[model samples]
Target: MDLQQLPGYLTMALPLLAYAAFLVVMHVGQRRLGALAALKVPLHLAALGLLLRVGAANLPTPWPARLLPYSEALIIFAGVVLIIRAVDAIGVGYLLARLQKRHVPHILRQGAILLADFIAALIVLRQYLNLDVTSLVATSAVVSFVVGLASQDLLGSVLAGLVIGVERPIAHGNWVNVNGMEGRVVDVTWRRTRIETRDGDFILLPNNVVMKDTVTNYTLPSPLHRVRVEVGAHYRHPPNQVKAAMIAAARQCPEVLAEPAPSVFLESFGDSSINYRLNAWTMDYGRQEAIRDEVNCLIWYQFQREGIEIPFPIRTLVAPPPEPSAHEQRQDQIERIVPLLLDSEVFQGVSAPDLLAVADRMNLLTFGAGEMLFNEGDHGDSLYLLAQGRAQVIKRTPEGGQALLATLEEGQCLGEMALLLGLPRTASVRLERDSRVVEIKADLFRELIRAHPSFLDHLSRLVDQRQRANQELAQALAQQKTADAAGGIGQILRKIKSALGL
Candidate 1:
């Protein structure tokens, strides 16, 4: 190799080597860092080009004068490209990181690179092209004004986009209400923002309009959003019961958050029913409709099972009154009670005639669903046979909530302990639906026990078995074991004998 031409050869060889290294770096960066890699490509190119220009300038045998300018221009062009790319990459990376909860410093780094590029470009232009950019700009005021006027809206949008990008007022995945349209932000660009609406349609809102319009970013401070649903139920059910049902329904929805917890409010009393609202928090606005639907569906089923009536609008028509007879009403009541008495195990041994006679004496009481028949610890002198519909036995818990102990359907009995030992009611019993119950008074039982001495044994045995069954139910629920359930039979017998003076 000729030693004198070594600088020229090295200039060429160094650029080729630099180009090869740049390719390797780009490959590695693209594989690992994606777009961030493109940022360094121009830098490598600029460095190699500068090296080539300087090496050629100092060569003992310099390149031809005509080729000198071209070579230097290429170096400056490479530097300019690197500067522009650095600004764009840094700015975009910062914006994306801010949107995604990733962190990057954008303004300082991007501005510095941009300023450095501008100075370098000025130097390159002055040194090579013999041009003054400042004087050129000063002479083009009319052209600048015309361009600005023509792209006013475009400029405004770009400025707005810059503001949003820097301030981070809205981000990707944010649930927002823009003007009257509600949607999730899909992407934000220089001139427009893309929003995916609840209807699954994408809407493009101009950046300027997005900045000017009223914006409600639901996920700004937090993603958990509170939503409320209004509903009406019949006035028969108590407020506490209604509230419990609504909250339970809200909690059933998987999208609902448990930390904040669900709540119910009594809004108002309507003409025919009570109005209520259920409030719950959910993070997914995308599935908000489904969440509400699931909650409402659960509420409907719960209301049905709890016998909570949801009233509907009804229109009335005038009609003439027909015949009314007290005898027919009394006969209906007797018939209603007869079957109930025959179905009860307490009257199992009694003949049909005797049962019918007893049914005639028994009082037929009616109760609407959700009506409390008797409360815990309330003095009761009668046991009830549910003749139609069902009833729920609810025991009050220490937490001020009600725990359901048992469900009594048609032919089932409740408050039996009241008549058996003449004790206070142990738990509250509420009608689960419109129902008629046969009330067998303590006096009636005393009279029947006195007439048939042998019947006392059967009655005592029945009472004892029922007490044991109740204890077992309590045990199954993981409750405290029942107290003193034994000897219920003897106690009932003694109480009946003493009351009847037998």
Candidate 2:
């Protein structure tokens, strides 16, 4: 505890105490300042350097004393790295906090650290070690030239990477197409950018090549991406009608954006048909293919409903098959419709002649999966008999969410109440699978009733029985309990007569 020895002890303990404090700070700030993880090597070097210096001062060995200069150099290098890392962490942390982003670009951060390391090394050599850095550089000029010449491509890639980092034309998670290769950017490094393709393949493109190639970033400027779908329709249909159908199809697709409403353009007149272009915006670039497929399928269904033909090419002159006569076509349709009508409980007791007449008047409409046959609150005058696919009856709840009330399979009927009363559709019917529906219009029902007045009683009783058996359907149709109690069959007959203007 002598005063003279206290100074010596303080000198020995001060550096150790300082190193301990730095370790604590690094540990505490590791989560907030991610850059501290890069300090592992330097931290180890600092410990070894401190130990070497201490041994040289107290070991009473000439060799230890001689190693003091090299140990001091190691300590200086470690100190420079520590200072650089600290600055990087603070600067990056501030930027991320202000910008609310997870990180700065990888190239910029690494490049800054490397440049700082080079400058620190030169200063340490010239100032602390007293080596003439100017002479050292001059002596290595020829070697530097040789190395630079050999790594010209590497150097170019590094520069290009720097440019990319600064410009930020592409970033991680961006969906981009470069030189016909489309993928999501996984990582960007000084030499190469890694992209993950949709097929789960990783592609490494050198930064120079990426910079040289034309790039299309679907997720830049905004995440919303515009998709174009081209289709051909028969020239018989007016452009406005075709456009309306195409736009409707696009809007029905769940992937398409509604804000910037879908649009259609008449592109050109083709040899066999008129070509149209549909432009829709969607934020999901990953599902681009699926979205396009859905839109195309929907367009087909819409065209089918609108009686718009996408004509076939007339490449070579060939004799066409003779068209069926009107009688033959009606017979074919009757055959298809009779099987569906026979299976339905609603048409149970109708006379054979009346059933045949009703079948002739009914039209078969095709709908694609996920297509709405009729949405709730729509004014519908046709009753749909599901003949070939599954459908879901979705009722909008009071809370603004939809509830699946029933799933309709083959031989099921919908819109009975709406068809009878000429009221708005009470529930939405969406096809779960591609469906063929026999749509019986109000005029057909009125014709049957006018010819046979007993047909009205039979139809009304059938509808009432079906509604009473299915409480969910009744509630969805908002059928009042009082109406059922006050002679449901009679009320329906009256409503049907009034609705059909009998």
Candidate 3:
């Protein structure tokens, strides 16, 4: 190596050594490199450019001069690609790793790479080949003006996409309503935004149109979305009563959030009915339709149980049959409940007249599938006798999960111990299908027990036996022991007397 040529030699040697080190790093950390693996193409291009430059230097004088510019141009292009790849790998992959995000906006990344390549090309033409870039720049401006005028819509859409990328008003997986089309954002590109509707159809909206139209993002700010369901009731019912019933119905749905809580607003007084809106919140915007349906169904059942009639329109052509009177409906319910009361073990010792009297006072309520009648540790003031369909008893384990304790079918009773002893409910009961249950309030139960004191002994023994059976079943399923049931009858009798103030 000549001392005078040291600077040039060192400059060439340093880049070669750096390229070799990069190659070694790529080979060693290929798995961890992720998107950086794309650097291989530029690395190969740089190697080819170096080989071409060396070969051109040794060729005939005119040939060496002719090929040198082309070789330098190749090297410049490869250098631009390498710089862009390095920025993406470090900025997106490494910096965003802590946030668990590994993505950069595609438009921004592509634009940056294109801009760098354009600048590199200008450098090669002006500096390396000694061509005047001022003339090229002037011609490009004129061409860009013509292209812009011809593809104004396309340019507008591309600009809109850039704005969207920067603002981030909506993102992938966000549930949004653009104009009238409601769907989840699947992909966003320079020209269009693709949304996947609930019907499994994709809608491609131009970015310009999306920017012009009103966009409702249900997933931004937070995933919690408020859904409203409209319902009508006869004007005869009080506003508070209807509101309470609607709120209660909304709470029964498992999808409805309890923290923000559900609300009911009396919207307006219609010609034939009072229109009300039920507002409920949920994180699942995709299932908003289903949640609304469930809330509507529960409201209908709750209205039926509460004797709140939903009036029909006043403009009917054909005459509809008159609804049954309150007395007639009461008689029908009592008749249905009488047989169920007779079949119950708790009422076995009571006379038929007494059972009929108890049935008359009881109220029959309907519940839809998946509705929770009561939850574990809830304060209970009534007992439920299943008249139709099935229900599951679920006990919450220590690990915050639920275990099936048992299933209750028709003619079976729940909340008996809670009602008799004034204890909190032990487990949650959820209806498996549309079901009906007769509710026996504490006052009615107290009246029955006071009238027929002998029935208490029989009820106590029966309750004790049922408790033991439940404990055994629970122990078998959950592999957990329950409290001892010995002398439970005596304890139950004392608790019943104390609860009822006998």
lDDT (Cα atoms) of all candidates against the true structure: 0.76, 0.84, 0.84
Ranking by TM-score: 2, 1, 3
Local accuracy of candidate 2 as per-residue lDDT tens digits, 403-442: 9988989998999877877778878999987789999988
Error of 2 at 244 (Å): 2.9
How big is the positional error of residue 161 in model 3, measured in Å on the Cα after superposition?
2.2
> Each candidate: RMSD to true structure?
11.8, 15.5, 16.6
Cα lDDT, model 2, residue 139: 70
Could you tell me which residue pairs clash in candidate 1?
A: none
Clashing pairs in 3: none
TM-scores for all candidates: the values are: 0.49, 0.50, 0.48
Per-residue lDDT of 1-502 in model 1, one digit per residue for the tens? 7898876677667766767787787778779987755556466656666656655665555464645775676677676777677655555555555556665333334455666665776777778977887896576777878988999988788778777878878888898999999999998877788999978899999889999999999988878888788889998787878988999888888889997999998999887789999998888767778888888899999899899998885644649587558767777888777766777788877767766666667888878678998999898778888888899999988899989999988898888766665666779999887787778877677667656667778876776676567763334323422345444455656765654455
For candidate 3, write residues 106-157 as lDDT tens digits.
Answer: 6776677678768877887787788899999999999999999999999999
Best by TM-score: 2
lDDT accuracy of residue 463 in candidate 3: 66
| lDDT minimum window of 10 residues, candidate 3 | 473-482
